[model samples]
Structures are given as C-alpha cells and as structure tokens.
Target: MGALDFISDYFSISTRRKKRKAMQTVDIKVKMDCDGCERRVKNAVSNLKGVKSVNVNRKQSRVTVSGYVDPNRVLNKVKSTGKRAEFWPYVPYNLVAYPYVAQAYDKRAPPGFVKNVVQALPSPNAPDEKLTTLFSDENPNACSIM
Candidate 1:
C-alpha cells in the first residue's frame, strides 16, 4: 500500500492539468471618442472566456473588467479594437504622500486622482529626517534639551 501510494503521488494526473485563474478585476485606460468606440471596447472584453462583467466609463476613458482573466490578455483585446490602451496607472490623490510631485501630477488625470509613480512616494527615511531636524541644535524652534 505504501509503494502504491508513492507511485500514485509521483504520477498524479492533477499536475498535467492547467491551473485555474483566480477571480480578479482589471482596470484599463482606453480613449473612446464615441458610443461606438465604447461598445466596441466593451464587447471585445466581454466576449473573452471567464469574463463576468465589463464597465466602461467614456468620460474617464476607463474600462473595468471583472472575472477570471489575465490582465495582459484583456489589454491586448482592447488594443485589438484599434484604440490605444494601457493598464490604469492612476490612484486617488489622497492615497499618495506627494501627489503633486511632477512625476505623479498629470493634467489629463480625472479630478481627485494622480498618476502612481515611485517618484511620488515618500522616502522611507522621511520621518526619521523630520525627527532629526526637529531636535537639531541648529533649529532655533527646536525645544532645548536640559
């Protein structure tokens, strides 16, 4: 029985099957000039296997796809419709520390949102540096130590 179990584990059929994709939501940025463009983009993504829903916001040029699908495949499908497309790169302005930094700020982004870029994130040492400055002798405003 032990030998049989070992052989069965070694030749497991489950290993040959493709792993199933987990549920996920993918947000894409696509410029749609009209209703036809919106419909085209929506239909292209909805027809994909495992896609549960698609929401298109033409005003923001954003398309949200929800299902068990790969993000790259979704982006490619949108691009196939003859529209320039890319993954959503912006995050809510309030979520970022330096949202107004040159690399993160964008005039084209919808209101209350800013581009997500490394340059816009606060440095890991920022808090420590602030503490050091607050206690430094050169800072007249710093509290005097006994």
Candidate 2:
C-alpha cells in the first residue's frame, strides 16, 4: 500500500507559488477619542490577513501595524472604521536638534537643516567661487569620504 502511494505522489506535477513582497511596517495616524474608538481601530486592523500585530496609541493618536500587509490596505481598513487616517510621515531623528518639538514634525526637513549639500549648482553668469578660495587643494586629507 505504501509503495503505490509514494510512486503516485512522486509523479505529481509541482506548481510554483507566487513570491510575496517584502514585509513592511505601516504607521497610520488615527485619532481615537476613547476606549471604544481604540478598540474599533484595533479590531479592524487585527482582522486583516497577514497582520502580525496592531498597536494603537490613543494619546498620540497613532496606530502602528506590522506585518506583510500593504500599507494602503492597512490605511483603508482603519478608514473603514469611520476614523480619519493618514500615513505617518517620519522625520529622521538626527536631522533635527530637537526632534520631539512640535515644529520638527514637518514632512520635509526642518528649517536651517541642510542635508546632502555636497555640490553647489552651476550658474552661467556667476563668478567662480572655486577660484577665490586661497587653500583650495593645500591639504590632500581634506577630501570627505562621503
């Protein structure tokens, strides 16, 4: 009986399953006024397939969902609960001197913060500032690794 079953299984065609996209964390800003709102938000996201966990912070009005689920789908699920939801915009910690401040929550980099300003843009009529510097190439070690 075992020999016949083994032979049949071995001859069966193997089908390749579709590869899934990389897993990502979906952070949504949903305002939950009370316990009921928090419960509803949590339940909606938890019921979604492939959602590993749902964390709702009522004080901060933030709902963080981690799993292989799509971010848009997670946002939609939260929105289905009748609460306004938007993708959480993240600001890099190091860029801002005071990240916790309310003004530092801008979608783009904060004021007076310069990032990746390696090269100055070329202007047709402008004077060459490169020629004005006195010790331009005096030190070979002045080159930045970045």
Candidate 3:
C-alpha cells in the first residue's frame, strides 16, 4: 500500500504540469466606431483572468489580447460587451494572386476584398502632348468667329 501511494503522488504532479497551457496571443476583429467602443472592449477583455495586455486599433478594427488565457474565453468576454467579435483572418495580397496555394485563395474571403498592389495613373498636372479633336488650336476651323 505504501509503494502504491508514492507512485500515485508522482503521477498527480506530472498530470498537473501537463494540464497547464502556455500563454498565447489572440487577435480579434471588432468594429469600433468611437472612443467609447474602444474603451468598452478594452475594459471587458482586461477583466478576464490571466490577461496580461489588451491593445486596440480603431483604424483597423482589431483588438489584440495577450496572456495565459484561452482564446475562446477572451472572445466570449469581448462579445459580452455588446459587440460582434471574430477571430482575425489575414492574407497577404501577393498570396491571393496564386490560387494554387490552398490557404491563400479561399472562396470564403471577406467581402469587398481588393489586392494590395499599387495602381499607376497619369498625373493630372501633366500637359497633353497632342489633341485629337477637330477643334484643336492649330486647326483652321478652331475658331468659328475668325
């Protein structure tokens, strides 16, 4: 009986260590319109146990929370503040061009999606070299008054 008790105690300690999960970071997309919305989300997430920090980006509508916490728990806490929340989904624009990559080009992409490439356009300040109109300055009928 004494030998059995010693073995059980050793197993219990190992089990406890295994159950402890490492700290993780979670990013969630939450649409915040004003300062008040940002405050509400920050306050709600900070209250959760094991939360070390909460960062909110109003421009990007993103909230990042870090600590030894379960992602689902943090998400639920933010949702409780009367705001819609979902895990942040990010995909690079370059990857979108290659449909062969299974992960990059998903049919479930967010709405109003556009590539991140820069578009080149003719400068409005540049002067036109030639005019194709019949009313050009050099044309004889340019001025009917003449």
- TM-scores of all models? 0.74, 0.57, 0.56
Best by lDDT: 1
Better model by TM-score: candidate 1 vs candidate 3: 1
Q: After superposition on all CA atoms, how large is the RMSD of candidate 1?
A: 6.5
Candidate 3 C-alpha lDDT tens digits along 1-146? 99999999989977775455678999898999999999999999999988999999888788999999999999999999999999887545544553334444445444433233333443445565234344577778768834
lDDT, candidates in the order shown: 0.92, 0.72, 0.76
Worst 10 residues of 1 by lDDT: 119-128
Q: Decide which is better by lDDT, 1 or 2.
A: 1
lDDT of 2 by residue, 1-146 (tens): 89998877777634445678678888787888999999999999999988888888886678999988988999999999999988865444665454545544444433443233223334535566443332356645445521
Residue 104's lDDT in candidate 2: 42
lDDT per residue, candidate 1, 3-60, as tens digits?
9998898899657888889999999999999999999999999999999999999999
Predicted structure 2, TM vs. truth: 0.57
Give lDDT: candidate 2, residue 56: 85
Ranking by lDDT: 1, 3, 2
Q: Residue 46 CA error for candidate 1 (Å)? A: 0.4
